[model samples]
Target: MSVDVITFGLNHTSAPLAVREQVSLAGELMKPALTALRSAFGGAVREAAILSTCNRTEIYCAAEPSAARELPAWLADFQRVEADALQPHLYRHSQDEAVRHAFRVASGLDSMVLGEPQILGQMKDAVRTAEDAGALGTLLHQLFQRTFAVAKEVRSTTAIGEQSVSMAAAAVKLAQRVFGDLRQVKVLFIGAGEMIDLCATHFAAQHPARMTVANRTIARAEGLAGKISAGTMRLAELPEHLAEYDVVVSCTASALPILGLGMVERATRQRRRKPIVMVDLAVPRDIEAEVARLDDVYLYCVDDLGRLIQTATDARKAAVVQAEAIIETRVQHFMHWLGTRRVVPVIRDLHEAAGAMRAAELERARRALARGDDPEAVLEQLAHGLTQKYLHGPLAALNQSEGEHRDQLLTWLPKLYPLRER
Candidate 1:
C-alpha cells in the first residue's frame, strides 16, 4: 500500500482565534488526539502528527488518499465542534501541495508574522511528539527531515528574518503604547515557556520598576525570576497579586482561560479603574474574551499582535518570494522522493527474488563441481542459469504480448538491461 502525505486543518489565515483555540491541542492532549487520528477511517491513517499553535491547528499525516475528507471531520469530532461550523475554515493538501505547505510553514513564509523563527522550533516539537507517540512513520519522518533542511536553507540564504517583528517585541510595543514608558508600571509575566521568556527579556530591557514571574511550577518561575531579577509567585497566587501589576503578559498551555471576566473585573475595581495592558499570547488563551470588555483593560491576543507587526512586512514579503522559490524547488524534490518511496516494496521484492536465484545457481554450481564436472563448465552453466532466471519474467511477458504492448516491452527491455544493449 502506498501511503500519501496529507495535511489538513485551519491556520490563522483560514480561521479566527476563537475557532483556532477550540481545535488546538497541546502537551498531554496530543497523545490521545494522535491516537484518534491514526485510528480514523478504520486505519487508513498510518502515521499522524498535529501542530497546534496560537495561529494554527494543523494535522500532518501519512495515510491513504481516501482519508482526506475523513481527517477534517475527525478533527471536528475530536475537538467537539460542529463539522459544518469548522468545515469552511479547514484546508486540506496532499502530494506537492502538502510538501509545499510544510516547507513554507517551516521556513516561516506562511506565518502571520512573516518569517517568525519560532514556528520552526514549534514544528520540530510537533515532530518529536509524534515520534514519542509512535505516530511518525517513514513518510512523515522523511517529510519533516526535508522540511527542516529546507527551513535551514531558506533562513540561511534569505533575509527573511532580518528586521523581524517578533511577538515578544510586539507585546512590549503594545504595553508602551498603553503606558508612555514601562519604567514605573509593575509587569507580571505569566507562564515560564519560551514565549513568556522571550517577552520577559523584551520587557526587562525597558527597566521596569518591578517585575514578577507567575507560573504553575514555582521552580520554573524561580528560574525565570533569577534570570530577570524579578520576584516569583505561584499561579494560584495570581488573583491576590493581579491588582498589583499594571501590565500583564501571559502565555500558558492551559486549555481554559486563566483570567475570567469576573476575576479581571474585580481586579480592575480593586485597581480603581487604572488601565492594565494585557497581552494574552496563548492559543487557548490565558485571558478570557469577555475580559476585553472591561473599561480599564487594553487586551491584545496573538492575532492582534500579528496586525501590529506590519513594519517588517515589506522586507519580509520581498524575502518571501525568494524563499518561496527555494521552497518550491525543495517541494518538488520531496515529492520525487515520495514517488520513489511508493515503489519501495516492489524494489524490495525484486531484490529478494534475485538473491534467491543467485543462491540457487551457486548451489547448483557447487554440486556440479562435487560430482566431478569441469569447473569452467559449471561456471558457464551458473552464468547462463542466472541470466535465464533474471530474463524469464520479462521474456514471458514480451512473448505473450502483441503490437503496442510488445513494442512497449521491447522499448523498456533494453533500458532494464542496458548492458545487453551495449
Candidate 2:
C-alpha cells in the first residue's frame, strides 16, 4: 500500500493536563522522541515530526496505513503510560483529515484560547526541530508551508483573531477578580517561556505595584524582566520571595511541579492569611494541586483559564465561519495535490519506457541506413516503429480486457491522446 499522511495524538479537548503532560516531549527531547517513534514501527513510519506543547502532543507522520493503528501504543510505551489509559484520549486523523488538522491547529482554530497567536510560533519551532533531526520530508514540508500560508491568509483576511481573548488576558482577568485591584498587587512570573512572557505583558499593563521574573537561568529571567521593566530572580530564590507577590503566574517546561503544597503553605503562613491569586500554566503544573486547598491561596490551572475564554465574540464567530470555509477549500486543494503524487512513479516509469523505445528505434534506423537501405524508407520505418511501440500496450489491453475494464480503457484513451483541430 502507498504511504499516507497521518496525524495522531491528544490535545486539550481530548485529554486533561495530567495525561497530556505524561506524553509531552519537551524541546530538547523532540529529536530523541522522533527517533523512538520511527524505531517503534520498524520503518513503517517513514518521516515523522512530534509537536509537543502544553496544550497538545501530536505526531505527524508519513507512514504506511497499518502503522497508524500502532501509534497509540507507541506513544503509551514511549511515555511509559498504560495503553489502556492513554487510548481513550487519543484521536487519529489520516489523509485529508490529517492535513485539515494541521491547518486548523496552525490557524489557531483548535487552540484552548481561540485565535491565540502563540501556537503558530510553537508549531514553527516544532517543524524546525523536526527538520534539524532529519525527520522532515517533502510531504510534511509541503504541508507545513501551506499550513503557514493558510494561517497567514486567515489571519489577514478574516477577523478571527480580532479582539482576541488570549490566555494571558484571561489570566489577568482572573487576577483582577481575585485581588480586585491589580495596581495594589505585586505579581511574580515563574517562567521565561512564551506563555509566561505573554502573561507578564498582560499583567504589566495593569501597572501592578511590582513585577518579577524567575527562571532556572538567571540570564533568561533577566532578559524578560528587562523588557517588562521588572525585577529578576533565580529559581532557587522563589521560596524566600514567594510571600512577597499577591499574584503568581507560572508556565515552564518542567516535567514536575515547581511549587508544592509545603512551599505554598509556608508562603501563606508568612502572608498572614492575605489572599494570593496563583495561576499555573504549565502542563505538568508548576504549582501542586494540593496547594488549592490552602485558605489564603486561590489557585487556577490552564483548564480554568480555558473556560474563561470559551465564548467568542459575535464578530469572531462570524470570522470563524469564514475561516472554516477557506480552510475546507484549501484542504480539498491539498488533497488533490496529494492525489497527483500517487501517479508520480507511474508517470516516471512511462517516461523511462518511452525513452527506451525511442533509443531502440533510432539505432535500428541508423543500422538500416548504414546497410545502404533508402534513407526515406528508413525514416518511414522509424516513425512506424515508434507509433506501434507507443500503441502496443493500449492495444493489447483493449483486445484482452472485457466489459467494464475495456470500457474504462476506451474512455481514458481519448484523454491520453486528445484530437487536435487542424
Candidate 3:
C-alpha cells in the first residue's frame, strides 16, 4: 500500500492551554505513545512520530488513509482525553498539507512565537525519540530531514529569528512587570536544563537579591548556581523554600508535575498574599494548572509567554513572508516526490512482467536453435514475442474502452509507452 503523509493534533492557535496540556506527552510516555499508534491501528500505520511541546501536540504518520483518520481518536484515548473534546480543536492534514505543515512548523513559521528557534531543537528531540521507539520509516525519516533542511534555509536566508524575544526573555519581562526591580526580589529557578540556564542568565543580568538553582541532580544545579553566584538546592527542597522567593521559574523534564496546587497553595499562604510570578516552560508542565487560579500567584505557561512575546514580532514579519515563500516551494517539491512514489508499484509490476516475457521468449529461441532453426529467424521471433506481450495490455484497454475512457487511454498510452524516436 502507498503510504500517505498525515499529521493531526492541536497547536496553540487551535487549542487553549487546558486542551494542549491534556494531550501533551514526553520522555517515558513517548515510546509507549509511538507503540500505541502502531498497535491501535495494527499494520494500517507504517510509521509515526509525535511532537508534543508546551504549545502543541502533533502526531505525524506515514499511514494508510483509513488509519490516518483514526489518529485523532487514538491520540485522545492515549492521553485519556475524550475524542469529541479533542476533535474540535484537532486539525488533520495529509499529502501536501502534511509536508507544508511540517515545513512551516520546523521553520518556526507556525509557532506561537513565530521564528523562535527553540522549536527546531524540540523537533530534533521528537525525531530522536521516534527513532528510538522504532517508529520512523522512510517517509517520515525523509520528511524530517527535509523539514530540518527547510528550517536551516529559513534561518540562514531570512531574519525570522532577528530581534525575537525568547521564552526565557519573555519570562523575565513578565516578572519585571510584576516586580518593578529584580534587584530587590529573590529568584528561584527549577531544573538545570537549557531553558533553566537561559532563564537564569536573563534573570541574573537583572541582578536579583539572591538566585537559587534546584535540580534533581545537585551537582548540575551547583554548576549553574556557582556561575551565577547563586545557591544550589535539591529539587526535593523546592517545596520547603518555595514561599521564600518572589520569582519562581520552573522547567523540568519530570514526567509528572513537580509543583502541584497543594504545594503552591501552602506556599501562597506562607507568603501572606504576596504575589509570586512563576513561569512553567515544561511541556507536560512543571507546575499544575490549578495553581494558576490561585489569587496571589502569577502563572505563565509557554503559550502565555508566547502571547507576551508577540509585541516584537512586527519586526520579523518581513522575514516571515520570505520564509513562507521558501516553504511553499519545498512543499511542492516534497509533494512531487510523493506523487512519483505512487507509481513505483506500477513501475515494478511492469518491469517484472517485461522480465517474464524476455525469459519466456529467450527460452523458446534457445529451443528453436537446438532444433536447428536459423539464428536470425529465431531472433526475429524472440523480438516479436517480447513486443506483442508488452503491447497486449494497453492495446486491449484502448480497443475495449469507449468515449472518454478511450480518449483518456489515447492521451495516456503514449506517455506510458517508450514511443518517442530514440
Ranking by lDDT: 2, 1, 3
Candidate 2 clash pair list:
none
lDDT of 2 by residue, 155-184 (tens): 999999888888899999999898787898
TM-score of each: 0.88, 0.94, 0.93
Candidates, ranked, TM-score? 2, 3, 1
Q: Indicate which candidate wins on TM-score.
A: 2
Which model is ahead, 1 or 2, in terms of TM-score? 2
Kindly report the root-mean-square deviation of model 2 from the true structure over all alpha carbons: 2.2
Residues 345-421, candidate 3: write the lDDT tens digits. Answer: 89999799888888999999999999999999999998899889888999999989999999999889878887875
Q: How close is candidate 1 to the true structure, as a TM-score?
A: 0.88
Model 2 segments beyond 4 Å from truth? 374-377, 418-422
Backbone clash count for every predicted candidate, in the order shown: 0, 0, 0
Report the C-alpha lDDT of model 1 over 1-422, residue by residue, as the tens digit: 55688899899989999889989887888988888777666678888899988899999988888887688778888889999999999999988999999999999888887788999999999999999999998889999999999999999999998888899999999998989888998999999999999999999999999999999999999999999999999989998889999999999999889998988998999999799999999999889998888897999999999899856666667888999889989988887887787788889998999899999999999999999999999999999999899889998999899999999998888888765434
